[model samples]
Target: MLHLRVIAPEHLREQVLDVLRNEPGVGNLLFYPGVALLPEGDEITADVARECVNDVIRKLKQLDIQHEGAITLHSLETVLSTRAHHAEEAAEGDAADALVWDELIARTREDSTLTMTFLLFMILACLLAAIGVATDSSVTVVGAMVVGPEFGPLAALAVALVQRRARLARQAVAALLIGLPVAMAITGLVTLGAEAGGWITLDDVKNVHQVDFIYRVGPISLVVALLAGAAGMLSLISSKSGALVGVFISVTTVPAAGFAVVAAVLGDWSVAGRSALQLLVNLVGIVIAGVVVLVLHPRKSLIPRSVQPN
Candidate 1:
């Protein structure tokens, strides 16, 4: 069960409340048209897990009474509103309205940009990840994952695919395809120098084969990518950003890339290739899953019969 709180002007309060009440799985609907105190905690309406939050906002715009308002949606750990749990509701992409693919693309644009911000973040991320892999420190690897800016490009790609923004889609794909390889190659060259200097030896890195066993190939990496993609998209759209944690957890891109770089340094091509393959699987999985999800879930009617506009 999700709880939503909406803050709008008193005059249009009833209309907003009515619309929210009509939403499927939305219960305990309450609106204060006249109350004038900022409520505690976050507004639940903002977190409302709808395929098209934009539509709801559009409908609310008609009321014309909104001064300053915010809505928040909370995923209840245990929703007693019905037998169905939040996870089940979430998994089904169950929402009151059908959201189109373009919405996801627009959302991704909100936080990410195509300029230098992308390059700087990724470089830093890859550098850190390479250091982590060479040290055989899982802690550093996780840190690199957190640091990597790959999620922004990934989310952008998913959004573009769903919305059919051909130009934008091509750009995003190019970024993802080109960004990691370049970064990894740089890390690899640096790793080779580090190894030759006796700063880190093959004994330290070679034993990592045990770590590569699981992620070498197959479906697990793909599954991680899919989940990461979904979580990354969800994080982009959501107000609370709880899913960011999931995004950080699900993507093996940084770790694998770092491992591959480490292997490159030690001249261990087999493990390097396997790790690179793992990273690829994860990337493909996330982008495909993100696109599929947005395609499946669509937003509400942008055009009403009476108010059709060209």
Candidate 2:
């Protein structure tokens, strides 16, 4: 179940109330007229079933409440009321299968943005990966994987493509194209500096054992990426963040990029090429898998004809 707090303008208060009253999946509705100071409107709160949330939010959007006032959605971790149980039973679909499009799009857009924080995480992850490669440390590589922010844009790109949002797709692609190369270049420079400081020697790179797999592009790498991508998409839709973290650690994206950078710095063009190929394979596999997952579990409209926009 979800809790919605809506601020509705005076003119739209009656419509909002009517919509809430008529929906079987909505209960515990409360209205406070002229209570919203910033928006200068009525404050309305209701508990709605997860399956019915998208319909309610879409109806709210059609009323232009998002522009004139505000709407906030919150998940209800524990709902002990009989009304809540009835609401869930009355809802059209299962809560676990629900896909809140508005929330998903907003989250992906925010994550895909090339912010300073994003760049910092990417650079740091790549540097960590470089060090892991040099020292042949699987633990360090996993840490870099967890720190990497590349999955956001990659997931966004898949979502954009599935939604047919060209602008969002372009933004995601741009972030990937620019962010990966920048991360790699910065990692390369850091690698050179480390060698100069005698922090990493050629022998360390050549003798890497556990981390050497990062630079080896193989069929297994693609399969792992595909599996991770599917798991990542499932985690996003179901809001299982812990599963998403596992997905991050399961893939070798950051480590591959880091390996490519260090290999190039050491004039190992063959290793560098293979690492670059590994990165490419992972990116392509993840995106393709994400799109497939979204396609398989589509968001269906449940809004009433009277409430739906023309």
Candidate 3:
């Protein structure tokens, strides 16, 4: 279930009330007139089944409440109301099967942004991967994968494409186009610095046995990427975040990028090219898989009526 707090202008309050009254999945409605200070409107609150929230949000958007008012949603972790239970039971579809478009778009928008934290994690992951490759440690490579933030933009790209949101697609692409190269450059410099400080040697890069597969691109890599992509998308939709950790560990994106950066640092163009190919293969596989999953399970309209423009 979800809790919604809405601030609607006086003029639109009636329409909002009507919509709520007609929605079978909403309950525990409360209204307070002229309670909003910033928007100078009436405040309303309600409990809604997760399966029906997308329709409610779309209706509110159609009312243009976002321009002069505010609507916020929160998860109702523990709902004690019998009315809420009835509302959920009355909803048409299961919550897990319902695709909350607005919530998902919002989440992807936030995650796909090229933030400093995202950059730091990508670089750190690459650094760890570079070390992992040099020392031929699969465990370290897995740790690097877990720390990488590349999946956010990658997932965002898929979501945007499936939703046909051009702006979001561009943002997601920008995050990747900028983030990956930046991560590679920084990791390469770090590799050079480490070598200068005698923390690593060329011998470490050349003697890699266990981690040599990081640079070997093949059908197996594509298969792993496809499976990881599907699992990642499922984890996001199901809110099973722990499953995302497994997706991270299963893919070769971060490790491949790390290997490419280290190989470039060592001037091993052949190895660098192969690692780069592996990275590209994994990225393409994941994006294709995510798009396929989202397309297959298209978003459903919770409400039949379109939101009227105010």
By TM-score, the best candidate is: 3
Clashes of each: 18, 0, 0
Q: List the residue pairs that clash in candidate 2.
A: none
Worst 10 residues of 2 by lDDT: 301-310
At residue 283, what lDDT does model 3 achieve? Answer: 96
Q: Write the per-residue lDDT of candidate 3 for residues 1-310, one digit (tens) a residue.
A: 8899999999999999998989999999999999999989999999998888888998999999889799998777799999988898777766766767777778878888988988888889988999898788989998999999888888899999888999999999998888888988999898999888987776777788888889888999999999999999888877789999999998989899999988888778888899999999999999999998888764543443234121
Deviation from native of the Cα of residue 128 in model 2, angstroms = 0.8
List candidate 1 segments past 4 Å from native: 1-103, 110-112, 209-215, 298-310
The candidate 3 region of ten consecutive residues with least summed lDDT is: 301-310
Candidate that beats the other on TM-score, 2 or 3, i.e. the better one:
3
Q: Report the candidate with higher TM-score, 1 versus 2.
A: 2
User: Model-by-model lDDT, in order?
Assistant: 0.62, 0.88, 0.88
Candidate 3: misplaced stretches above 4 Å? 197-202, 298-310
True lDDT of residue 207, candidate 3 = 82
TM-score of each model, paired residue for residue: 0.62, 0.91, 0.92
Output the better candidate (1/3) by lDDT.
3
**Whole-model lDDT, candidate 1?**
0.62
lDDT of 3: 0.88
Report the alpha-carbon TM-score of model 3 versus the true structure: 0.92
